[model samples]
Target: MDTNQAGPAAEEALARQEQETITQAIAKELGISVKQVRTTVGLLDEGNTIPFIARYRKEMTGELDENVLRDIEERLSYLRNLGDRKKDVLRSIEEQGKLTQELQEQILKAVKLQEVEDLYRPFRQKRKTRASVAKEKGLEPLADWVMEQRRQGQPLEEAAKYIDAEKGVESAELALQGAMDIIAENIADDPTIRSWVRQYTASQGILVSEAKDAEQESVYENYYNYREPVHKMPPHRILAINRGERENVLKVGIEVTADKIHAFILRKLVKGPSPVKELLEAVTEDAYKRLIAPSVEREVRGEMTEKGETQAISIFSGNLRSLLLQPPVKGRNVLGVDPAYRTGCKLAVVDDTGKLLEVAVTYPTPPNNKKREAAAKFKELIAKYGIQLIVIGNGTGSRETEQFTAEVIAEIGDPGLAYLIVNEAGASVYSASKLAQEEFPDLDVAERSAASIARRVQDPLAELVKIDPKAIGVGQYQHDVSQKHLEESLKGVVESAVNHVGVDVNTASASLLSYVAGVNATIAKNIVKFREENGKFTTRKQLQKVPRLGAKSYEQCIGFLRIPGGDNTLDRTPIHPESYPVVDRLFRELGLDVASLGSKEVAEQLQAQDAAELAVKLDVGVPTLRDILESLQRPGRDPREELPLPIFRTDVLKIEDLVPGMEMQGTVRNVIDFGAFVDIGIKNDGLVHISQLSGSYVKHPMDVVSVGDNVTVWVLGVDLKKGRVSLTMRPPSGNDGGAK
Candidate 1:
C-alpha cells in the first residue's frame, strides 16, 4: 500500500467511501434497506424519473412508491452536495498548510455543511481584523501562552517581549490588549467551543418579541409581548414571528443565560488555576459577546426558520395536490362567473366538454344593479347552453353573486340547477399569463378568467396546472417560504397527481402534460403542436413520433398518457405498451375478451382470479400484474371520483342566518396547522379549531380533513360584526364552546 496518496487514485478511494456513507445514511434515515437506496440512486443516475422508477421498475426498487423514490432522490442530492462541500473544505484547509490528521478525520466525518464550515473557521482567511492586526504585531506568542495554561506566570511578562514600537505595539498594556484580541479570536474560532455554545443557547434560549408600536393594531397584535423557548416554537409561530419582524411590527431577540454559558467556557479553557486564568476569562467573555453571540443567534434562527419553511412548504404542497385532484364535475354544462362590483360579473358558459359556448357580462349585483337585464341575460345563456351547475369565483362580490344566482335558480324552479363556489385564487394570475393569452387570444382578461374558472370545475388537474402553484393560496405563509424549494415540491406534487390520474393525451393541455413524468415544457408544447398539425393521438405509440420525444422520454412518459376510445382498447387504459403483452396474456389465460373490458362480468372475472398466480404465468411482477388487473377491471378509471363531491347548493346562507348549533354541510376550503377553514356558504370561511376537529386528539388538521373535503359541521357561534363563524365537527356537544 502506498503511504502517500494523491490525484485521481486518491479521489477514487475517497469517492468510494463517500458513496458508501451516503447510501447507508439515506437508508437509515428513510428506514429502507441500503440496497433499495443504491438501486434507486442508480436508476435516478441513469435519467430515470421518479414516477417511472416507482411504476415501471417495481421489482428493482423493492416496490417503492413515487413519494419514497422522490424522498430518496432528495436525500441523495443533499448528501452528494454535502460530500462535495466537504471535499472543498478539505482542499481549502490543506492549501493553507494547517490541515492535521485529526482535523482531516473530523472534517470527513462531519455530516452537515454547518459542521464542516465550523471546523474550517479557524483556517479561513479573514480581512484585517483586530486578531489579524495583533498577529501582525507579534502577540501570537503571548496568546499561545494564555492558551497553554501550564505556566503559573503572568501573561504581561510574555506579552512585554512582543512589544515592538515599529509594528504598532507601543506599550506593555497595548501589547496585552493585542494579545487579548488574539486569544479572543482563537477562542471564537475553535469549532468545539462554537458548536457547544450554539447547542446550549438553542436549547435554553428564549425567543422574545415586542411590538414596535403597541398602539398600532394589526393581525400580529397577539405577538406584541410574546415569549417562547427557541427550541419549542412551532412552525406556524416561527413563520408568524418572522413575518412580524419583516413588517417592522416586532422586535425579536434570543435571550440566553449568560452565567451558564460563561461557566461552561471557563471550565473548558481555564484548566487548573494559572496567572493567565483571569486573562483567559476576560478574553472568553469578549469572544462570546463580541465575536460569537450574534453569529450563533443568527445561525440558530436561520436553522429554525429553515425548518419552519420546510414544514410550511410541505403543507402547501399537500394542500395544492389535494385541491388540484378534486373530482371533475364531468358531463355538466357549467356557467362560470367572475364576480366584480365595478367591472360587472364576467360570465362564461362552457358546455360539458369545456368548450366555451358564450361570454357575456352580468350586472346583477353592485354598482350597477341591472337586475332585470342581468337576470334575463343569465337565463338566456343558461337555457341556451342547458346549464346544470354554476362555478362562481370566490373573489370580489362573490357573496352577492351567489345570492343572485340562488334567486335565479329559485325563479327558474329547476330541480337540477345548483351552484358551487370554487376557489379562484390564481384565476387572475392565469388570465394574465402567456399560456392563457395563447389559449384564448380573442378574449379579454376577465373573460379568459371566467372561462378558466369553468374549465377548472370540469377538470381541475388540467386547468389548475396553468397557474403558478404559489399563487394558488392553499397554504398559510406560502409567500414566506423558500420559493425555489416551494416550487420544486409543488411541482413534484403536481407530477405525482398527474401521473396518478393518467391523462388522456388528446384532451390534456400543454400545462397539464408538462407535469407528467419525464415530460419537459418543450416536449409538452411539441405534443400539442403535433396534435394540432396532425389530428388527435389515437394510440400511445403516436407519442414516440413527436419531436424531441426520444425513446427514453417516451418510455418514461407513455404509461401515464392515456388515449380513451382509441383504436387500441389497451391504449384507453394505463396498461403500458410494454405491459400490453402481459395484459393480453392475462386476458387469454382468463378466457376473457379484451373488447368487453370494464364490463361488470369481465371486471368481476378479473377481480376473482389469483393475481399472484397470474403474475407468475404472465412473467410480470406482482405489483405490475395487480395494476394491469385494476386497469382491465375499470379502464380509464379516475381515483378522484371516489372522494366526496363538492357540496352542491341551490340556496345561499348569510352570516346573519347562521345560528349557534345549526348544523350545515360545507366543503373544506383550506387546512392549516391550527385548524381548517370551511366554506359554509358565507363570505368568510368559518374556522374549525383543532380542538373542534374531532372527539379525539388531532395532531394536525390535515390528518382529519383535506382541501375539498365535504364535512358536516355545527355552527358554534357567529360574529355578525366581524363576519366570522366558528364551526365544529364533533357533533357540537350543544355548548357555546363547542366540543373538546
Candidate 2:
C-alpha cells in the first residue's frame, strides 16, 4: 500500500461523510427535504448569492426565503467547523493510544461543538493536576483496586506497598489519600459521569444574584436580588443579570445540591460494590465538589449567556429589516433640519430627485431666540423650493424645531405641507465619512448631514445603506452581543431589503449598487465609472461591458438593476434578460409587442391568462413566469410602496399636552424585549409595554410590532416629571404598568 495515497483517500472519504451528515442535519432542523438542502448547498458552493437564489432560482430551492437561505449558510459553516474540530480531536486521541471504538463513534455522531468538546475532555493534556501527581507517585494500580472493590483486603495495606518517601508518599495514610485523589479525578474525567452531572445540575439548579452594593442606585437595581430557575430564566433577564455582573454591581451564582449529583455519579460508575463503599462514596463526593460541580455551573451560565445573545441578535436584525424597508416619501422637495442648541439648526433644501438646491442656518430655540427670523426664512425656503415635506432630526432641539416648522406651515396654511421627525442615529457618522465628503466636498459636515436627512426621506433604503447597519441603532444590547454575529446578521437584513426594492441602475449610488444580488464594492464603483464614461445604461446587456462584471455577475445582478426610460422597455422591469425569449414568444403569440407593456389594456389581458397554462407554454418555472407577468404590468415597481408610510405631523404636541385616553397615531421607532417606543408627535416617545401592545399575551415585542409601523395608540398615563407617556394598542382598561 502507498501510504501517501492512503492518507489522501482517507481524507476524501471523511469529507464526503461529513458533507452528507451536514446535509441531513440541516434538512432535519429546517424541516425541509434533504434534496432541497443538497441542491441549495450546490448553489451556495457555486458562489451564488442568497438574494439571487431566492428570487431567481426558486424552483431549485422550493421557494425558500432569503432568511432561510442565510440560516442554511450559517449552519453549514458551523457544521464544517465542528467537523474539522472533530478530526483534530480524533487525531490527537489516536496519537495518545487511548482512542476506543465507542469514543470514536460518540465523537463522530456529535452534532454540537460543545458535545464534541465534552467527549474529548478526558484525552486533553492536563497541567499538573492531582491525578497526574498521584500517577507520578505510582498510585494508579491502588486506585484501580479501590475502584473495583473486589479484593478482600484492606485498601490502605495495598497502598502501603507503593509508599515512597522521596516521591511524597511518606505513610500508609498518605498513600491511601493519594489513591483516593486519583480515584476522584478519574471519576470526574469520565465523559459519561460528567455529562450526567451537568444535565442534573442544570435541571435542578436555582440561579441567584445579589447586590454588590445594596445602597447603590442604578439601572440594574431590579436585578440586584433576582432569582430564577436555571431552566426557566428568560433571555432578557439573563442578559440583564449578566450585564449587572459585568459592571460589578451584582454577584451571580448557581445553587445545586452536591449530594444529589454525587449519588447520581455513584449509581452510574459503581456496580457490584463490596467493602470500600464508604471510600467510594467519599471519593465520588470529592469528584463532584472538587471538580465537576464548579465546572458544570460555569458551563450552564455560559450557555445561558449565549442563548440571551442569540435572542437579542434575532430581535435586533428583525427590527433593522423593518426599519430599512420603510416606504419612500417620493416625488417631493424636502427641507431637512439638523437641530442644535448653540450653533443653530443646519438646514438643507433638497429637490424631488434628492439634489441639494440650497442650504441655510436658523436658531429658533432658546439663547438664539431668532424665532421670527427663522420662521420667515423657513417659509421662504419652503415656498422657494416648492417643499412639500419637512424632516427634522430627532436630536437636541428637535421638538423646538418641529414646533417652529409646524407653526410656519400653519401660517402658510397648506394642509399638504407636513413635517416628520426622523431618527438621526448615524447622521453624524455618515456625514464625516469619506463617501459623504466626496458627495459634498463644499458643504460642511452638519450641512452634509442635513442633506442626508432630506434624501433619507426620498428613499430610506438608499440613504441608510450609506452608513454601517450597526450604527443605524434599531436594537437593544447590540454593543453587548457578539459584534461579528450582529454585523453578519444585520448585513443580511440590509442585503435582503436592498434586493427586495430593486434599484435604478442610472440613479443608484455605489453604496446602494454594492448590495445588489451579485454586485460588490469594486464592481459597483466600476458600474458607476462605466456609466460616467459611457453616459447612461440603455439596456441590461450594457452592464456586461463594465469591468470585472462577468457572465455570472451579469446573470445574478442584471435582474435586480432596473433602467427606467431606457431604450428597451423590458429593461425597466425585473424580468431577467435570459427570459426575454420566453416573453417575446408570449407577446408575439398574443399579437402584441413589448412596446405596448404597462398599458391598462395590456395589464388586464395579462392578468386574465391562466398562470399555470402560460408558464407551460413559455417553458419557464411558474414562479418565474408569475414574477415576469407582475413586473411587466407594473414596470419599475418598488416593494416599499406597498408598506405603510411614516406618519407625518402637521402639529407638534408636548408632554404636558398629553392626557389619558387620548387617541393618536404614532410610528414605532424601536422595539426591544420589554416594549416598543412610539413617536406620538411629542418631544419624547412613549412606551407600549409588551403586555399592553395588544389585549392578548405577547411573547416578545417583535411578535406584534416592528419598527416603522403606523399604529393608533391610546395614551394610558403620563409622568410629566420623568417626561414619559404610557400607551396601549388595546382599548384603555384604565390600567397601566409604569415604565420599568
* Candidate 1, pairs of clashing residues: none
Tens-place lDDT per residue, model 1, 1-740, is 12145777887887787788999999999999999999998999999999889888998999998889989999899999988887788888877788889998999889888998999898888999999999988888877877788756767777778778899888888999988998788888989899999999889999999999999999999999999999999999999999999999999999999878888888888878788788887888899999989999999999889989988998898899899899989999999999999899999999899998889998988789888998999899889989999999999999999999999999999999999899999999999999989888999999999999998889998899999999999998999988999989998898899998888899888988998888999999999999999999987888889999999999899999989889999888877799988877887888888788879999999888798987888888998888888888988889888876788999988898888989988888889999999998889999999999888788998888889888889988888889999999988454332211
Candidate 2 regions with alpha-carbon error over 4 angstroms = 1-14, 272-275, 732-740
lDDT per residue as tens, model 2, 522-641: 999999999999999898888989999998898889988999999899888878888889888889767777888878999888888787898887788888888888888878788789
lDDT of 1 at 680: 83
Clashing pairs for model 2 are none
* Span of ten consecutive residues with least summed lDDT in model 1: 731-740
- Tell me the lDDT of candidate 2: 0.88
Worst 10 residues of 2 by lDDT: 731-740
- Candidate lDDT scores, in order, read 0.89, 0.88
